[model samples]
Target chain A: MYLEIKDLTVLYDRAMVLNGVSLTVGKGEFVSLVGPNGAGKTTLLRAIAGLVKWEKDTLKGTRAGRITLEGSVKFDGEEVTNLPAHEIVRRGLILCPERGRPFREMTVLDNLRAGAFGCKDKKVVKENLERVYHLFPRLKERENQISGTLSGGERFMLTIGRAMMSQPKLFMIDEPSVGLAPKVKEDLFARVKEIYEQGSTILMTEQDVSFAFDLAGRNYVISKGHLVGEGTAEDLLADESLRKTYLGL
Target chain B: MVEAILINGLVLGGMYAILAVGFALVFGVAKILNMAHTAFYMVGAFLILIMTIMLGFPSLPSIVLAIAIMGITGSVIYKLFLDRVKEHPVAVMIISVGVAILFQEVLLIGFGGHFRGIDPFVRGFVEIAGIRATYQQVIAIATSLVALVAIRLLLSKTRVGNAIRAVAEDREIANVMGIDVSRMCVITMGISAVLATVAGAVVAPIFMVHPLMWMHPLTIVLAAVVLGGLGSIKGSILGAFILGFAETAVVFLVPMGAFLRGAVGLSVMVVVLLLRPEGLFGVVFEEERL
Candidate 1:
């Protein structure tokens, strides 16, 4: 019950992207939601982080009217389903969205500094920034480089490092390893583990079944906007039907 | 004669730069061309005209109040109207044009068709570069230069200012980083209005103020923004000076100078835009598309 979702449903116009989905992650738990494409994993994460709610509120009454979202998201026993994205981040829930999507115009250091913008204490902001640099020394080396100029591996580091600056209690990362080389993916996933050990709970979604199974203590299989299966990596792997059918493992 | 022309061109161009900076800033961050922006300029000029001429108030405090009133109006326009239709750029543009006409008609009803003007904010003359200019011209140059510098410092030094730039680059990304994109948009609109109102109030002493005053600045600034590359501050300032000199050079060097002012200024923009579609100082890769 540390981070809980219940009866969450999201509809874009007439198509349902998430259907009455519910899940939970205890404090310090490392969970992975693994599935193939079109499985509503990103939508579920976006819904929990308050971005989908914002889109619903913003787009309502427009010509492209009405995105219906019905859900309850509870973080640390507090309902955050209706909060704005900024407010949600303030409450220690950060969503490092898919793709690096770094502020392309800003330098690497500035982009990292922006991550800690919500913090009031200058000392804390500086400390968090230094921690991010320590975790990824490559970022320190390219601190002055414009983000748009960084290589794919570097952009991924900056994206994860930028999320770290927020000092989140629970980090939700979507497809952090996508498009990365196998070698770079190994390095990046190792850093993700280091981040978990540093005492931040994590909920990650991935298409790499072997990687997810190796990293997560618990796993959920989502396909076609429904939570089709859930269990420990061993338990799910033992079920041949769940492995071959929904997860493609 | 050449020195006089250059100084006057710089002075007038400085005003245009100040006026267009707001237009560029609003468009840069919010992507709303805000046709109503010049409406704030007109409103500020009239505010100064009324306080100084009819109420016999001191000009400095009147100018300050005029800027303050326009600042609030700018915020209201963004929040109440612009924010509502932001998803549709065409709708936002139309609403802004509507806002402009609404303010123009209000001024017409209140001030009548007769022109009004304000006394100089300061009285004196100084010689610079072998050219004698009034204190008003000096004030215009100094104010615009100082405002531009302050804008630079604000963008570089303050967190809110940096947040504004981040939002301008990509609002959704900025939002995910915990910056309030909506708040930044409204605040940017407010700052843009302040610049426009200050430009209008400061220039009222030199020129006649009327309901129709908004049209010329709107045209010149649109040319400036388009010439300098849209949504770029440096480009807008550079474009303003170039257009200012182009217009003035027409009057200075040509016999039928007065008749050719608008044509000459616009021609420079057209040719440059054809040659360099992105304007002189437009960022090479960044299109301000987002």
Candidate 2:
């Protein structure tokens, strides 16, 4: 397994957000986690990417909500459940958070440059930036424009492009196609497909079933914080009861 | 007489702006009201005094050493004190006020609560608009201007500066993007301390240094920053100039304006806030701004 999770659980001050979820993504595999709202899908991805751990450390004694994370996350044969977010990014596991959260007041170019912060090789950074520009021409078009001013589709494109600059081995993206126009979503998915085809492992959580089925080779049906079903897209679609009960298909 | 006043007003405004810029920056990037900044300024002046008078150091080196000391003190304070109460504004304010008083008390104990002055970096001045401003005033104005321009360039052109701005916009998002946000906070605190110290070093000859002097100047600079809208360097400069010009006009134009110094500053702040609630160039404080 390229990425492995064993008994991962998260609790936010007595409210259980995740419950001992175990899953795996093989090297160079495209896996989609599909679930409805309140399914703990975002929390799982965040936990895997070390955000939950960061929150647990930062909000320990504050009036802010407490987060309790328990899990063993092994990425590339190394224990990574307790690493900080930036250290995880340094290790080539990147998370593109939901809803296109860029540094809003910054210019698009600056945001993209910030993504390459961990990379020291200037030549590699330049090449990655050029590739990001090529992947999302819209981001290149609005390179100098402030991120807050970008449209919905443009903002998503910028964020995804920003993540690409980090050169991730396992790209965990949460709801990339949400709130985008159908045509723009199609364009974005094509870019994602291009990335997958180029050999980086991808784990994405999406609400859109058909979109996930079309792109992901294997799928996990998670609902209310537990992995209810796991199989290939064809197997899940073939089972009528499983589709109706869990996937809402 | 008007020319002389105007010249003095601009210089005074420039010095005020320099003093407040770091305060604005710390708030802008960190969202912590560093009320202890004025204490750092006073300490800087005293450092210069001890160096030049007691240790027999040159005037320029004393100022430089003071700035360096304050810069280190800033990072240490952030790590030790401000870091604990960063998320709570009221708590931060209280702690900062406590720190300021502590600094004042320590300085008083050591120096015996007497006002003292440092030798001016320069001794003479050239004619400006046919007004005979002393080198002390000219040096204050020139140092502030040079520092401002250099800082502006540093922020706009450097990678580290860009990282600082990104963190200022949204600290969490900046961290997620692989920028070290805690390191940026330390750097910002250090820079703000240096600014306060440098301002003290340059302006100390004219204003003199006393343990309690920090309280009044802090109040004035806070007013200037608030009027300039918090967290904006340009706003700080504009607001300081506006305050300086208003104070100058009062002293020369009104019959008993010298006595109305405190009232004049208060009214100037009130007028600016009444005219534009966001200050001259500052953004509105949105809930999501943090």
Candidate 3:
């Protein structure tokens, strides 16, 4: 497993959010975690990002979980969980969270610079920025404009572009399709798929199960906090009972 | 009659601008009112006084040393206390007030209960457009303008400056981008402390340095920030100057005397709040709580 979770449990101020959730993602693989509203999907992703408050709550199971990135987390792969969120990004495990917009006050170019924050090498940052601009030429055109003024579709693109600035080995996006029009959603997903094909591993939690499964090679049906089922996207798509019960087809 | 009042008003307005700008910087970026800031200004006065009177340092060197010491003190406070309190807004507020009290006691213990002053850096008056303004007051105005410009450059031009702005806008998003929010917060506090220190140093020659000077300045600083919109640099400066001129003009024209000048500031603040609660120039001033 390129990325592994063992007995990971999470809570939000006493209410149990995730209970002994375990999963794995292979190198360069696209994985989708599909679930309903309030089904602990985001909680699991937040837990992996270490933004979840762990010690404040109770845990009955072995909360011992490990995330091993082929090397150390960064190019020199050392364990990065103990580090702060910024350090985790420096190690290339980046999360583009749901509904979180770009820093509205900053210009688009400045927002892009903020994304490449942990990279000590200016060259890498410049190269990554150029590549991002190439992928989303609209951002390049609107580089001077303040992020707050950007359209909804543009804001989503900037968020993804900002995450890409970190040059992550694994990229996780939560509900990228949320709040976007159908055409905008299609454009955003196409960009995300292109990013995935460029050798970065992806783990995404999405409400549109059909679209998510279509993009991801493997689908994990998450319910309440457990990984209920996992299989190839085609097998899971073909299963009628699983689709109706877990996916609300 | 009106000329003296106008000149005095301008001086006070400039002073208020200096004090409130520091408050707004910390509040805007770090989201901490830093109750200790007024105390830091008081400490700046004392530092300048001690350097000039006891240590025999030159005026420029004394001011520089005061700013440096206060910057270090502010950084230490951030690392030791404010960093831990960042997530706890209410706790930080209470703790900041406690810290301010602690600073007061420390000053009282060291300096005793008496007023003092640093020797004025310049002597005599300048006739500007046939208006007689003391050289010290002119220096204060010029120095403040220079400092404000420098602060603007630091906030808008530099990389760290941009990062600080980014953190202030949205801490979580900045963190996701890999910006060290703690470091930015610490730097903001440090800059605020330095500004407070400079304000003290600039005004020390004209105003007496005493243990209780902070009490008077704290009111003005709070009023300026609140009226200007809490956390806006421009708002703080504008509010400070407005209160400054209004109070000074009232004192000069009414002859209710110098002692009542403090009440002028308080009243102006109250009036601004009554008229525009969002402050003189703030957006999201009230809704920020939500």
Best by DockQ: 1
- Selected candidate, larger DockQ, 2 vs 3: 2
Rank the candidate models, highest DockQ first: 1, 2, 3
Candidate 3 on B116-211: residue-level lDDT in tens?
A: 877789999989888888999888878888888998898776778878888888876677777877788888888988988888877888888888
Model 1 clashing residue pairs (backbone): none
Model 2 lDDT at residue B115: 79
Q: Which ten residues in a row have the lowest lDDT in candidate 3 chain A?
A: A66-75
Tens digit of per-residue lDDT, candidate 3, span A40-104: 88877766665452222112122322221111222223445346666667667788988746888
Kindly state the fnat score of candidate 3: 0.69
How does model 1 score on DockQ? 0.66
Compute each candidate's TM-score over C-alphas.
0.94, 0.94, 0.91
Cα deviation at B68, candidate 3, in Å, is 1.0
User: Where does model 3 exceed 4 Å of error?
Assistant: A54-79, B1-3, B86-90, B285-290
Which should have the higher DockQ, number 1 or number 2? 1
- Give residue B65's error in model 1 in angstroms: 2.5
In candidate 2, stretches whose alpha carbon ends up further than 4 angstroms from where it belongs are B270-276, B284-290
Q: State which docking tier applies to candidate 2.
A: medium
Listed for each candidate, the true contacts retained, as a fraction, are 0.62, 0.51, 0.69
